[model samples]
Target: MGGVSETHQMAPRPRRRRRPYRLAAALLVLLGLAGYYLVQNESTGGDGAPHCTVVAGGDAGGSYSMNLEQARYAATIAAVGTARKMPERAVTIAMATAMQESALRNLDHGDRDSLGLFQQRPSQGWGTPAQIMDPVYSAGIFYDRLKEDVPDYADLPLTVAAQKVQRSGFPDAYAKHEPDAALLAAAFTGRAPGALSCSGPLPQDTGDATRVKAELVKVFGSALAPKAGPPASRVAAQQAPADDSEVTLSVSGKDYQGPADQRRGWELANWTVAHAAELGVQRVSYGSKAWIAGKNKGRWIDKAPGKSGDGDPRNAGPDDVRIFVAPLNR
Candidate 1:
């Protein structure tokens, strides 16, 4: 009681604690920002999420990039041209046209009755909706019209040729896609060997040999028809005395001749690689190079034809384009 009156400190005011809700709110804001960046990165292909690119001029030329879906349809468009014996230039024209019209999407909806890769209108006599929807069919008619209607389309300006076929309100739009389309045409037409590559995740289901063969034949015509032989094996094939892969596309040694034949082989081989993911193709090989799905699916493996070493699968015969499919998931 003796002059200690000022000692009433009131328990130090119980040091104010930080609120838990405020900390949670701050953490949530940080998480949301991180998630947004991750999505943006994936969308821009910062990771390997099934993308393709074409390098036309080795290192000197400009390159183009496309998602897997665009690559598949683009390959089909190129195959249709080549299958009809259309020149590489013709394929370039057709691809550019499709890129401008539909961005290579097999859309079921479009301007009026327009549909499919070419946005061909069934009402305009392109084909039935179902037919137009088929990439092979749409591409086939596009080339036919380009050839029959404009027999000298190759010599014309790329835009002029495309506009004649498309009759689009935006006629000049196609010309912008020509440089990229040409890169696609060269790789897909097999004129520029090993110029295209696709990398990404594998499908959950396995590849079907029959489906693979059918698509090849449909796209490349009779040149890719399977030879008369034993039925496809339940097991995969190798470079042994007997080629036992699911499908064998003989680039016809007897008929497949000259530089064109090599180009043909490369064309079919490149196409198989392009459709590998969709068709569940496990491996595709021609000449000395082979592409295997999964981790090494990004690039072609160089191995001697009719030989397998270094744990690599056997490549197709120098004259053959072989495709091996994965066994069914069942």
Candidate 2:
């Protein structure tokens, strides 16, 4: 064959281009993933939806039944911090106090007609009966005091700070509820977002410790437990105690009967858990039944004879669902 001239030998035509469909498809997938994450973070819109549970008590027509609802609602609003802006430690302290004070209820009565979740006594001018009943308003007042008190009282014991504002009959009552409060704060503050959850009768927010534990497992996984048995060092517990206030929120009867109320309970629980360390909570428990070492399903249990319900004998009964907090040093 005769040798072709260099100019005559044309380069192979460039490969024909295909449509940009593949590139467009990849971009759409990326956008979809981003949106999903945003929703999960509850950043796409207002404070996002609350993740809460229900806690029933009494024969369904008693003080406990009524109080449970209040407690649940209190937990939800306390967790709010303007979307992701909430602090984990702050939420924890809120939970601890809620556990100790009113068992999370915004009650109308106390030692001297104390009102709202903190048991703000009308005698002491905490608030009027009507104002205390408003979850949002009540939570705001509590936070205001907390913000001021917590700054200087950061190193103080959980009970100590609580007592400064509460002036409770027993200053040490808040100490016990610290542990679980911390756990709930961690979950609610978005530090452990999606970590707090409920199971069993999801519809009923009974303060069952068993169900609380189950929710902990659902959120934090089995790794929440240490390789060894429960820790023995109080200081260690204080340093890094296992958060156990698994019952973030419980909408039993009066307080959180509606969906809005239930959502509010979840927010408070999450906030408390997220701020556990800051609030000085080490562990948390709720419902009529405390967490059964290793069980699920919270049953109605009476308070111990001497212990009293959450330390208040007047508050004790099979009907009441008490919230137990952990020690400061764990």
* Candidate 1: residue pairs that collide: none
lDDT by residue for model 1 over 1-330, one digit each (tens)? 555455664455685667788899999999998897665444323544567878876575888888889989998898888778888899999999989888989999988988999899988889899999999999999989999899879789999999998899898889999888888998998888888777754555666666776666667676455345432211123345242336766664554577766887788888877787788776676778776655453666777546763233555666677776754232
Error of 1 at 290 (Å): 1.7
Model 2: lDDT equals: 0.45
Q: Candidate 1 deviates by what RMSD?
A: 6.8
Give one digit per residue, the lDDT tens place, for model 2 in 143-228. 67767756755667777777776667788878887766665454444343234432111111123344444433333234323335
> Which 10 consecutive positions of candidate 1 have the poorest summed lDDT?
229-238
For each candidate, give its TM-score against the true structure.
0.79, 0.40
Whole-model lDDT per candidate: 0.75, 0.45
RMSD of each predicted structure:
6.8, 19.6
